[model samples]
Target chain A: MSEELDTGFFADWLRAAATAIDREAAHLTELDSPIGDADHGSNLQRGFTAVQTALAKEPQETPGALLLFTGRQLISTVGGASGPLYGTLLRRTGKALGDAAAVPLPELAAALRGAADAVAQLGGAAPGDATMLDALYPALDALDAGSAPGDAFPAAARAAAEGAEATVPMQARKGRASYLGERSVGHEDPGAASTALLFEALATAYGEGA
Target chain B: MAGGEQVGIVLVSHSSEVADSAAQLARELGGGEAAPVVGAGGAAGGGTGTSSERIAEAAHAVDSGAGVALLADLGSAVLTVKSLLAEGDQLPEPARLVDAPLVEGAIAAAVTASGGADLDAVAAAAEEAYQYRKV
Candidate 1:
């Protein structure tokens, strides 16, 4: 199989992400109820559903275009902190991808690194902040260490899942949960969980295709 | 007056009602000749959320050649505005995201803008509101 990713790969990746978010919506909301507003799942589901609909209605010819459109959709549709953070991730990564019709594994890794940095910059949250960065930074690190895109995704997904779990004991330093101070401890961060789901979807899509 | 025009203000919040109310309060506090105030809040369709598109639209609507000062409430509101600003081309020159308490910052910015203050002055006014003590 080719190691490069095309627009079709991104479309499938987004579809998989939508499905996974839908499936885990309730669990994500449950995770958020304690520390957050309990709307993470619904917000993501709504955003991803809009992304799915937009892709179906007018599909883009290039991966960058597809992801840019997806980011815009999420920014407009999703409410709360995740919308902008996730939107910035996809949009900045899409911008880094530029106009290339297909991107190789190494290029995609660089784009993901840029995306993770953009998310951190936008949210002002670093790794271990009990936020999405907790999961996203590790996923990016794993991807950076991998040899190829298709093979790297599973490892990245595993790292993201572990990173999300690691947030269970962290005190939030940003976002609404931070308002809770030390009380935010002991609850799994909803944003981190959703971010892990995003990596998992990527792994699932690439793994099945591979 | 820095550029012969009043600086504009955009109020961002997760709730549209809160944004509109804040804008109204700021306008009242600033009195007549208040710089144009735009409320960018909630989802585009409605309900609780912040929309970058809406914020951009508001920034454009209020741009009077002087620049804009954005006052945001909550985490997502700030993130969305910052992401929009990072995009570079979407906002006019001198557009700034003021890191301050939303209501107080909006009021202070509005009052400053109404006096034909420059973007920097309005942003500073908003930032100054951060130190407001309510005893």
Candidate 2:
């Protein structure tokens, strides 16, 4: 918590993301089947695997470069809206990190906040839109709110999970789910569910010294 | 933008076949003298999804200094194009994602751009198709 997250840390985070995405891919697809095209899990699984492969092949010198590379990989490999949406989140956050060798946790969270805002703008979505932003916002909001810096990741992970579950009762107003209109209610948004997994990966990676 | 070479046109779809068909239709409507038209479709690994790489390539392929007008089939397709545009990757000085129906908008944009329309005109032409009704 006191140290900055370096390239290795970012690498570990993405690797965890890849593993988590693979583990939960089927569940994600199940969530999407009702409201979306039922491709979220497969799409993210492929994208994160590509990121994992890229990390193994070429090492980026800094956290920024690593995240940028990961973002580009996701954008190119993952199809559908998640490609661009998640791509923008990572790429923009990486860009904001600005070639730094390491970033403190608070700074990383701040960069993500800004990037999440950019994603919201790109998607024309707000907090209640039943999208990834639902999970992202609450998690980021919880990440730096307390005195115990070491507690941040766990708190964020829980907040993200809760945020995702909160989407179950809300009608989607963004992404493929929105096409279902009122019928979108009563199901967890796949994007939000995946977003919870992302935060969980981040927490685990940070705990593992990523 | 009046050199008459035409602004480039790109049709994006989840399936390669649909994207290609849309481009072909737009070109046919232009009487074969329209701007460079291309299809950007499918994920990199050959599946049903939108690819920014394909989109960026098509935009690059058709760009002739007059900018490019891009149309997308649905959900993720539109988002993919928007992300590419936001990347600002030297994409023909200007590449725009027009908000309009894919097929109708592509034809209208193709014809207008083939007439040496500027980027704004091409995009507006595409959006104008939103008002078109054939019911």
Task: Please provide, for model 2 over A5-79, each residue's C-alpha lDDT reduced to its tens digit, 9 standing for 90 to 100.
Answer: 788778888888888999999999999999999999999998999888888899899988887888888888889
* Tens-digit lDDT string for candidate 1 (B46-134): 88877778898999999989999999887888888887787787788879999889999999999999998888889999999979899
Badly placed stretches (over 4 Å) of model 1 are B1-4
Lowest lDDT 10-residue stretch of candidate 2 chain B: B84-93
lDDT of 1 by residue, A82-115 (tens): 8888888898889889999988978888888888
- Candidate 2 — what's its lDDT? 0.87
DockQ for every model comes to: 0.73, 0.77
- Candidate 1 has which clashing residue pairs, if any? none
lDDT of 2 at B115: 79
